[model samples]
Target: LDPNRLPRTIDGLINALTGELDDETLLIIDDAHLIDEQPELRALIERFIMAQPPRLHLILAGWHEPDSPLIATARLRGEALLIETADLLFTSDEAAQLWQQAGKTLPVDFDELMSFSAGWPLALRIALDATNWRSALGLREQKSKPALDDYLEREVFARLPTPLQRCLQRSAGLRWITPDLCAAIDPTFNSSELIAELRRRRLFVEPFGEHGVRFQPLIAAWLSRRAAADPEWVHLHRKAAVYFQQHGDHESALYHQIAAGDPAAVTTFLPLARTLLAERRAEAVLDWMRRLALTGDETPELIEIQAAALHQLNRLEAALATYRRAERAFAASGDRLGQSRCLRGQAAIYLDTVQPAPATDLLRRALKLLPRQCGAERIELLLMQAENWAN
Candidate 1:
């Protein structure tokens, strides 16, 4: 179909297609989910699907399920059948048949081979190629994280041009692609050209909507590892921080800025650190902090983050010491909020040490400095205030 000839409205498009479509017509739309972003278009598609034109084969391929509610209705009514990842799994019978085509008889434990594959077609292919399926089956496992980095690196990423690889690397952390975000990552970004390249190269990038796309997680992980050591990694993160900040995403901005080792990273990271600590995610926060701490220049923000981590481990005295240092830095910088946080931290240590007088004084001072509107912080201060007097 010609681009200019394409209908401007869903009704117009459906009417045109209705006149043209008949038995033996096969319609295919790759990345169909992207086209499903428009409510009107999705509605049209649902009607088209419900009609189920006689002898017409229609395919709407995408990584995700169709966005049409009618598709769900069709499924519930037994008018539509879904062939998903599970159905694509190679059964022992299918595998044996394929092996027979290659003149090999069924081997023992073939079902065991299928079991290890868990219906993943690629895993099955790899196992079938192995001389010993049992050994291959024994080595199979589920990973908490994606384990396809090496395979993708060798088979896909390594083959790309350096500039494209770098582009993908810098953009990996993003959940979706838009012209604005791409431009934010690198001002030289040309959305149409990059999208065209991705499609031509058959990369894992998929259309998210009319003007959006997303990287497959495994591909993103692989690119992240590949670009981890690049000198531009921090600079790229800094750019990302600016973008996120401009877009009103302070939390994400803080993460990228922290990675960039900006002095403000700690101040921004503190509340999140406290939240993670409270959530019992102290270990994960520590791992994140340790990795970010590698630059070896500890700012007040880093100090506070470390202190917060220490507090989670109940290393009271050490946390108190670090908090004091962070407090002085905040006071000197005229950052009342930061100073208030440190004071609260120190007060907690004092109460734990059975020193109520000093703890009470610290809490009172912090209460004056901390914003009254902060619900969590205010609640924390109130609890600590009560505990200080009780002790």
Candidate 2:
């Protein structure tokens, strides 16, 4: 009966076990993926399964689906049941019960915790048992969580095949990964197959929309941090930027461009800013500009766009300051049309604030900057000037 001297063949093993079992018995094989390459052991298990031994139950559990013929046959016959990650996820009630066991109540922001955990038991445990559960779920940039990192490195990432590992890490650069996006980033790998493998492994990859999937938030944050340190970080992000832009996801494109630290982010963001401002998403435009972190080299057009966005957001003082800066830059560059646009923006802001005198003065300066051929600009400036002077 010694484990070290177990019978090698199926018949020998069944014979050895026959006399020892009288009642229903259950045998569970964990890490079944490890035995996938052991043909002899696999064959023995296949034979044992086919025999359908009475009063015996078998459970094979692992991250991967085993490549077994008997299992496939049994699946078709409805004789074998599978419990996936979704089935095993902890519900809110289950999470509450865990907290009850710890002599505490669930946090008020329970939904956010759920997002961080994605119902994974290990993640829930880590968050629940942390010194500050909020801090644990923060998963902030450049922060270290030895427990989660060790588990992901040893059990999750290290266990993956090299190609799959690379695919997973590279795909983390995108907010929502699609086959086309992955193909753009890493052409050598079959993007669909790699994503399918990650899904099969239950590596926190979840269906996002019709054409996209996203890694669980915590896993994504961790993987993004790791990917940032990779040599392909810039290349991957650049590719993602191009893909998102091609797909007409301009916001995501702007995000990736800024993330890549590309000089072209400003150029890419300028047109998108106008759309965002037109849609009254002025705050979003400002946020993107903050991420861009432009120094003193802003193009007059970009400054005017930023000023307009600020004005839309009702940040009057900031808008006034930004518009003035744009006017100075345009004047320095000898762009009379650009300078006129800035003056008009400033005049509108002044008019909004009920300062007609300043508004009329700004519009008068704007009219001076436009040529006779600039018919639209002259007409717009004159109308503003006449309106402000009449007021």
Candidate 3:
């Protein structure tokens, strides 16, 4: 039975089970780890097991023990059968059979192949298919990086379709991808299609419920290298940045946009920095501000953002310096609003450093700089002056 296309609903599961069964049938659910997170499916499976005739037996095989509610329910009624993958490893005779199947004469070191493959069925199968076991053993012993890359490249990447290859490239840039972002990247893509394509190609894409997907660390690293030289590297980064930004993941968005080297990322990150500061995520605000300060192009707005972040982080000396720089830039640009903000940020720095006297003086000067009818500006300055006096 194909576990991949298993019936999702309780009635569907029951009908499928009844139609597939004969007298005293043994129903095995392999890779039980895959269904552990699906509580509904697990409940349906449990219901089927409970409703089954006495002649039916259920066997579950998985790397990890199943943690489903069904497992607990079945255990309460003493109905669950569990077998671990470790129990399926080859014995001495089975190892000999595998070696023989690979068309190799049994040497004293024959069992080393099993040890090298860690007796994993898939790994053992792949090793056996590698031209000759003896030669492959020799290469494996030498620890040749090129040989390993070539083996994995041919065995893995060479089998993927072009679109999947692109998907993998994007996935490499991310720790995880949401379904919405994946759909954005590949217009025709869906979760099931992505899973099927990756599984069919034997690529290491791991599905996490309905919203997330991941790739093996090694595969992701390799795909990252493969994508480094692609002409669309910048485009992919920008696309990922946009997707992440749309999802309100500003940190991830900033990372991709920084990789793309887009100066406009500074503008994108400023509001994010403010939000982070508001959330009291000071460390993250500091990080984004530092990146924006270092990587972003020079502008009065960018400098003001850097100054604001520095102020929030209690880097009073740095904030003061940044405010001075922004003040000069604003003066040169004749931007009175920018100049007023720089002055206010400088005053805040002074207040942060226990210099409330100077801070009050700075706020009074800033208040005079604005027009009398600027009610919002006057109210803000009044509040800041009151805070300074309270300090």
Candidate 4:
């Protein structure tokens, strides 16, 4: 029966499930996060638990550790059993058994191999395939960097629709992408349909909730490489960055902006880092600034922004280094305005570190670099120098 065609009421769901399924029926709902948003469905599940028919069992699987309302309700009524995925991977003996089952002779240090995989089934399986079990003693000696990307490119990306592939690339730009933002990026595409297609392919696109999705770390890394290769797709990244910035998702916004290669994104992200600094979120600010540096195309203005962020985070040495880099880059580009700015930033760093002589030298250099006709910045630099000396 089509659930959508049924009456949109709790009675309809209870009637449908209880009437259609046998008392002995066991239903497994994987990815409960996706279904929880449907209050009617949650209510139906709740009602089933409350009714408590003999031999009826419901199993829910999700990444989140917290219990949902449905899970809590079922547990309260003594009707649900919770099993964590971590418990299912393997014990050392079990891992050895798996290796033995694959017709591999174990090395003396075989336990190390199992520990390295952390009992992840996929990693174990991949290791088994990559190593020659018949000559297992030499397996440890044959340290191979697995071509994980090649495997996914063939197995995963090859199977997705072009639009879904584009969506995945855009998602790589974001730390997280919700369905609404995904819809915004490709207005003509249906998020529901695309998500279903991705799930069917087992592409690591896990539901964040009913309204959002996230990529597994390995998959996110792979998609980022592919996205970097295609400059045309950068616009989708920019769109995601702007959306996240508007919603106050600063880290996510910074990620997408860096991926999109938008200069304006630097402006949007700098203030957030400053706010984080103000709140004593110093470590977080440093992390974001490091990410900004990795983008590898810093303008003098961007470098100054990064230096200021670093200085606020109390990373005085890194701030000085960034200022020096900005100074060199500006001089190479012959951007005198940028050079003057870099000099002033370097002077500030020197002042903060109590290196008054160097600070005075930098200020004098900055005054010279500033166009004689442009007196405003020169005056500001002199005032800053005077204040530094006073301190």
| Strongest candidate by TM-score | 2
Off by over 4 Å in 4: 1-76, 86-174, 187-210, 222-299, 302-325, 328-337, 364-383
Cα distance off (Å), candidate 2, residue 334: 5.5
Q: How many clashes (backbone N, Cα, C below 3 Å) per candidate?
A: 1, 0, 0, 0
Candidate topping lDDT: 2
Over 4 Å off, model 3: 1-167, 196-210, 215-222, 242-253, 289-297
What TM-score does each of the candidates earn?
0.44, 0.75, 0.54, 0.46
What lDDT tens digits, residue by residue, belong to model 2 across residues 1-391? 4533443455666766666678999888888876566775676677778764677788998887677888988889998898877898999889989999999878888888887887889888978877766556547543665467777889888887788877877776778777777778877768777777777677788887766678888887777767777878888898888988888998898888887888988888888988998899998887887889864246888888889988998999988999999999999999998999999999999888788988877888888878899888788788887778777
Q: Scored by CA lDDT, what does every candidate get?
A: 0.68, 0.80, 0.67, 0.67
Per-residue lDDT of model 4, residues 231-256, tens digit only = 76688887777777787787777777
Winner by TM-score between candidate 4 and candidate 1: 4
Clashing pairs in model 2, backbone N/Cα/C closer than 3 A: none
Could you tell me the lDDT of residue 192 within candidate 1?
62
Residues 1-391 of candidate 3 have per-residue lDDT tens digits of 4554554455575666677666787777776644555765576566666677455677766545555665777677866654444567666687678779778766556566665544555555555566655344333223344244575678666655577666666566665666677666656666456665555333455665575666654455455555555767778788888888888888888887886788878778777767776777767766776655554236787777777777777788888988889988998998877788788889877876768988877798788777778899889988999989998
Would you list the clashing residue pairs of candidate 3?
none
Ranking by lDDT: 2, 1, 3, 4
